[model samples]
Target: MAELYSRRSFLAGALTAGMLSTSAGYFFTRRNKIQLTLATGADPTGGRQLLVSMWNRLNPNVQIQVREVNSSTQDQFLKFNETHADIFNLDVIHIPRFAAEGKIVPIELENDISLVAPVRRVCERTGTDQLWAVPFNSDVGMMFRRVTDKRADAPVTLKSVLAASATGPVTFAGQLDTVGRQTDEAFVCNVLEHALAQDEAILDEGGVLSYGLGQWRDALAPLADAIRRKRVVAAAGEDDTARAFQRDSLRYMRNWPVRYLPLDRAERARPDTAEIRIDRLPLGILGGQSLAVAADSDYRDEAVRAIHFLTDNPAQKLLTSFGFAPTSVDAYIDADLQEALPHLSLVRYAVEGSRPRPIHANYAEFARRFADHTRRHLHDGEELTQQFITDIRSVLR
Candidate 1:
């Protein structure tokens, strides 16, 4: 459970960035020089120095620097708004807020704009018809398997998780503290999608409220029951889950693969422990990241170039090399890359079926309401589900 902050409070914090570094030089340059700063997630090999190197190689006159922001920071929007940065690696849901505030520039996604249709559709759903961002490093939740569990079988649904728990230990990142954070948010999104899949209308034609209470109730009941019954252990952290999996104490777990990258197979095995396996987040649901330009940037043209270079097939393939699932629709079909990453099909399904987080101007507020409600139900013994839906509706409204 990362510390929660109200949307208003986060906005207020934007007024407190006098400590941020000032622009190195005026935007005016002799040779079309554009100074761009990119705010990226905390992944060391992701959207970091590599993007700067690649962009510089493609556009020598452009100066782009990468700034690392702790993914857990609720005040990330504030930092984006206050920075001298011209570009950003923003989340899809958070983009609306910055766009609504006139702090982000909408991108002009030309030159085969369809490269990332799923990302584009998400912006359209948010009523941001103009491209508000570019695709940086993209990702999706992947299902992992312990190598020893050679049953040659893997569970791929809510029902499977519940059933697996009955036979052996299942661990999940269940701490309420991790709820509002992006990884945890993705976890919850999967839960919501699993619930919505049971209903035909998952999301309305307008892509607003989902209206299938009965199915949602049924879909989530097993998860709640498992948590309450001690058949499943809720880890306070992802590391805890990883540790348990390493000890052969965990038969199954759900989280992004980045957490597992730091561990080698030998360290993860207890003599007979087989290598862990990777697959996309369960079908019918997916979650990941997108890159957007700051509305306030004076360097939109140059920013667009940088965005393009980063998301194009060549760069996307480069990202794949770094363990990030490429967002490009075509990358999944690349024979060589697919061979290198055997789970490309699963990743493709997760990204294609993926839905962005609620893309409202007040997204943080909505996230808070949803997180609180989920925490109450999953942890506090709040057995009521429909009432929780009502509470969410009130806040969202």
Candidate 2:
């Protein structure tokens, strides 16, 4: 009877081991086949699709699904919270707020130091050494003028820009003509770029608001005079300005490098018609999206791998071909890229010196208040009173 009991126990132990081996095999198989979800703003040129296809060819086991969200930062943030996608792209300015809320997961990139210095600098949380996102693509404010004009050495200063405008058609999207709140932020960006170029500090060392109403008014006065004299065509936004420039209605404009892609293609086709020349802005505003992983994502490892794949050298080169400026320094220096992007050197210079927007948890509120008051001052002839300064201070608080 004892022998029979010992044999039964041995058989039971063998059955348990068999079951464990089958479970392990199933787990490993599931781990090898991961599906990742990515949320990003609409890309009309199918660039995002092409990028995903390239990624899939390199990584055959992982599949990526893309979802299109609203272009606004606030809307994207809302979607991030609601969907909890494995990965999401956000504007650099939004990094601080998201980090403060603990919504994003910090990642350790192997080549973090190799990215463009200014672009890499803004990925960290303010007043701390923690990094929250990876730089994907970047844009800066640049001057676009007709190549044939050759007037005033490309307007190195705001004064020079105004002086050149006096000679020919110069238009900017500096108007506060919109009834809705849509154009307010663009107006503020234009103002900040001009102010920074003149060495005016918008925030002090301690990150408190420092630029006074008087200083801002002084910086904007020249543009105001041009608008009044009909020397500057004040459009509503960059799209309007680009369209006007395309139709040969304007000789000079301030726009992003992405806007130059179509113009470049057109010039290539014509080869004899007017071509556009781009140069560094007096001060360029840093603009671009950063990739962040979700803290609660089920596929964190896969998501990180995807981020690395997208930011790798080859992927960055592809991004430039799609009219997006890559953050990788190598991509900027590639000879083929320089030939394709005639303004590559100027872009590199701008990226190196570009000024980051204000970093604060309540930055959205601050921007809204600043834009509202500035627009009112520009359009309604309202005074930049002490009360206005006080209101801005309250919003920052």
Candidate 3:
């Protein structure tokens, strides 16, 4: 992760000015300047803003504006029903759904920097030979442990992980409340990871579920224990979970890359604690955002140009300087850029090996089913059935 102090120096001077050398042939003159909108979540690192500002200056005729996108994944999907903006920044998991619905159009997303394989895979529509989006950043789930813990690694089984923490089993406290009433992506990702671990073919590209009935009990035993024990911290969301993890006397946390900053700081202030990362999990879930052109937009070609600028080599490096994981494999090649992220090695491990959550047009619904069913079975002790797997296919539309 890029420390705040390091980010300031890394983005200090030439980083903003270096783009003045972009080819003039690709941009129109200032007199022909036109505006385009980019919808993306707000980044605390301010890297997103920097990339846009740089693009505007170099390609004055193709000036871009940033629109603060909705934080809710469902809300973002709804906005995609029509051309909400010229450029849509989508969570990688949503790409398949949005592309299938024609909310985002297919474009041969070319990149000057070769993106990581896992990152590249999410940009594509499942079961198709077409690319629908360009990866903007990369994320992967990891198990964090306190250095004081006797277990040097993540516990072998789900049960062992629950008891690893000193303060009850709040270890997996992130989104524990998503049990009964579903719709939480974190909870869904957790269930999907375990299922994938059991059998890679459990879910097909069309969103069909086909694992053994016993797989449900085996896959969600930990969730059941968490509910019965009521040991999970009641975190409202991801940010709240991070804060709660910092405050709780817990030994393990499952979260994304950006967590290193806050966790590291918390450990620094605590006299008896230090954090270490267990990046190599049995399987890690892919998490990140991608850029796509809106299907209804009149400026499809122009939007594609904006996508190129935002994901170009320099912009990716600038995002790296601000602590965002680079989707581009080339970002790691720069020695200075590597220094900005102290946890680059682990980040590499997680990103390269991470697997996407089940791909479906109605992916959010698919996520809800897994989250809802897991909670249902745990609450009522309902065993998985062949009908249950059959019903999972209903989410295809």
Candidate 4:
């Protein structure tokens, strides 16, 4: 067994501002036949549906009619646009655009619980005085390597990891392709992470991107080098990388925190490697959904209360136990969770320092353009020149 965690402080109750004996959870009596529609994608973890079931049991009077929007993030997003659900579990990246468009209503958190910093930031609309949602469940990229033993708080850098790749045992892999997917969200995210790791100033306060010589190309050069050296491989997506790493040759791979549980369990079953040490990458890109209330729902107050229940401490603990990364810091440290998913510290650590992918209303189009531009460069030996950067800049607008 291996143990790991990343640098710095987790976001604690920043959404609540100051913590006192205050709770945002509201309960109502079963006076009326009230059923609120919750629109969320089908959850594999089943943690979310369980939360709904638990909430339903508690407040039988005000029941929830869940409308499982079964599909990918793209499909679910489009479904939300077509349907009028009271509560929406939306991708955190989409929250800003939703806020900007007035599609979702404002939400407040229960003051007693502290959300991870990066998760809290994703809930907030930048430069605005409001938060659109409470982080439902959080995801972030992390490097899982089979190590000999846990080290003593050592810093892992992009330079060091890139150097680790040789024509030998452990090769680096990531979700680098758009294989059989409607959108190239994973591909663009990996690219943005590489660039963001090198230069934090690439994007300005308003999320406008600007970069210079070597800042863009230098970061990706090593990846190309590794590909040429046969130390890195093209991946279909996260699932491909996850399955590829199990083959022993691809020991080091970047994947979601939620993946840690299944991977760890599978490794434990096989005992192929010594110990797997999970690391938070520099400029870790965050991913996940947050619970938001529909602006046009009739049951606005009830929906707000449900959001609190779904995201608060109790719900978070259950969700974490079920292999879903939680939003609350307290959920990460819960005694039972400490044993079941010991790597939660790593999740908390990664998310503390993680950041959301580029936020744009036309993010899907940007992803498409980015994939078309970078695929050849990454998969083949083609170079990404200044023209590549210019094309990206044009699409960003």
Candidate 5:
């Protein structure tokens, strides 16, 4: 057996070699007891634990060993390389890179999986025309406001949000404070959402990089004006905005559904607190995780079975109980789940309309460069000068 390297080292080698070896053989012996190792990020909501329990109940002969990995995708990949875990859970955006590197094996479905069309699309590897991962939970950005607000209608667009804010009926907050290339991922996500709302494309169908320079300017101009006028509260990240909203200092916020879980709990505990109302963003970025079987795993069969068990209708419903949006279309319409999660319809709308970030082997590099320039543009008060635009274009190329 060859030694596994860290994700960074493996990526470097893969880039140089143009491909990774996927010839590892799987050998399984029939036994009374079977064990599988699963590598995944730490779950605060205990959703993974519930899945493990369900799987164990269904297959008493098999036991799963869960190993918690880092939250960072790169760090999770590093753990995956070192452990060669039977099953690896990772972000949907990483599917392209991991599949290209041959770190994850393409999954063959014995029966059709009921994943929403958008979520299913993200799991497919364009280059190989294979399904690289099984969609577990899906997310998309949405606008949240207090239920007590007197607004006659929801802010359906960025222009509407700004207009509402200008009238003093509501104050808007978003993740806009960019520190450096190290700017918050939410900030970068927000920028992409803004651009996409205007029908912009960062990369075309052929995977060629292109900077929608004009679209960037058009999207940011109104947001900049709003920030200047102090109608939109510019916060560092989601937490900051959430805190402000909780204090009734801000009337509207753009954030992920996960943020709502806690706020909803707080509202239930204290009716005096801001009761939240959710609505889909006119456009937003999709965010979520998927499960993939490692190419080098010793328990490929067991791993695939585990992924299937996790994504099944019952398990997906359990996931929604943990505040995760389900990838299954049926889960969105389930009567019981709909009663528990009143925002299910709004979430379904957002997920259907949301777009995934650009998928490419070099996406990590592209995201870093995009964040760096957008941060400078938004925070440093740098005008989108011709030279600066050229620099942005150069980074994408």
Candidate 6:
């Protein structure tokens, strides 16, 4: 039966001689368990813990294993393409890059596990939405505050944040992580640029790309100035954003809901220090992760079932319970969760209204240049305001 199935897959893909031998041993057996390897930058053991519990309850026979992938570097999980995995949990920004490379299979969404609009963009961007992966979680950006600094009346907009954080450091990720490619950085950079553009602070309607480029530079100007002025310092990824604020260095921080779940878990696990505070990615744009299935997986039937059970309301609620926002439009409106997680409203608003970075295939190339420009202008005083415009034009062209 294994040989027969292998032959079918080979015929479907027209596997070369070497590839044929590679997949020869691929099939389910009583002794071997079906494996689903998911890649994520932030270790989602808490979320996985809940899913595993539910998965065990639903199907005791099929086994699912979650591998903590350092997506920033792409060293650990990149090989999954050579030997297909059942499912992939991918960073939204990385989707376009992955899709462009044809490394992923198209998703045929099954059951109640419908793909969210934002996540659908991943498929749309990759042109593999219907074929590869089902949208898993719709993560959005959230603003983190120190437990003691929470004033009943706090600033929520970027403009106000700048004013209040003028004298202190506002936090954000400095170094790109495993998944921190150009696309990922663009999500953060573009969000700020989008807001600044709307305020007439950056970008113009000519669509010259120069105008947009100018806005991006201008948008980052204040934040860069803030950092130079000792008002903003790069926080340690999303995980440290919350704690960095607690240390009195960061008065304001922007991060994803997933990064802070561990902080929340720590709060529950040990209530010693202080309660972490969260809000949306500051009335700007946000990004998230989605789930996709291997186009070549034999367990498509079971894979679809697992996806459905993992993304619905019950699963989303479980996510919310762990301090991560749900992608479901309903979860965005859930008053209880909103009250529990102050950032929930922000995430919902961002998701409904947030814009992703340029969906072009060249985004990865663009991101590399953008980050270099940011470092040069923000760190090295390389006159990025004008040079940025020229460089982006060079890349876009």
Top candidate when judged by TM-score against the true structure: 3
What candidate 5 gets wrong by more than 4 Å, as runs, is 1-32, 73-83, 127-129, 149-156, 166-170, 178-183, 198-210, 228-230, 268-274, 385-397
TM-score of each: 0.79, 0.83, 0.84, 0.83, 0.82, 0.72
Candidate 3 to truth, TM: 0.84
Winner by TM-score between candidate 5 and candidate 4: 4
CA lDDT of every candidate: 0.57, 0.67, 0.67, 0.69, 0.69, 0.53
Query: Which of the two, 2 or 4, has more TM-score?
Result: 4
- After superposing candidate 2 on the true structure, give the runs of residues whose Cα lies further than 4 Å from its correct spot: 1-32, 125-130, 149-157, 164-182, 203-209, 267-273
Q: Which stretches of candidate 4 lie over 4 Å from their true place?
A: 1-26, 74-76, 126-129, 147-158, 180-183, 197-208, 395-397
State the RMSD for candidate 1.
9.9
Distance from true location, Cα of 374 in model 2, Å: 0.8
The C-alpha stretches of model 1 lying farther than 4 A from their native spots are 1-34, 57-60, 71-74, 113-116, 125-129, 149-152, 171-187, 193-207, 211-215, 236-240, 247-249, 257-270, 281-285, 385-387
TM-score quality measure for candidate 4: 0.83
Instruction: Name the regions of candidate 6 deviating beyond 4 angstroms.
Output: 1-33, 37-45, 73-83, 113-116, 125-132, 147-152, 165-213, 259-276, 281-283, 334-343, 385-397
**Local accuracy of candidate 4 as per-residue lDDT tens digits, 145-198:** 755434533446554656777544446677766664443667667766666666
Better of 2 and 6 by TM-score: 2
The residue-by-residue lDDT of candidate 3 on 1-397, one tens digit each, is 2364456475534555665565343475547657788888768767788778877877767878888854666555765554368888898878887877778888776656788887887787556755799888888777666666556544443345654433544565555445332237776665666555555565443334565677655666655666566665645456766767667766666677766654675575676664554454556778888889888787788888878888877777777766677798777676766555556777777788777776666777776666666656655667766666666667754
Write model 2 residue lDDT over 175-198, tens digit each, in one string: 323334455556666767665655
> Candidate 6's residue-wise lDDT over 124-196, tens digit each?
5344436345555666555655454334535455556655567644443322221354234633453344345
Minimum summed lDDT over a 10-residue window in model 6 is located at 15-24
- Candidate 5 lDDT tens digits, 177-258: 7554233567778876665555446433333434556766776776666676677767777777787776764567888887
Clashing pairs in 3: 33-61
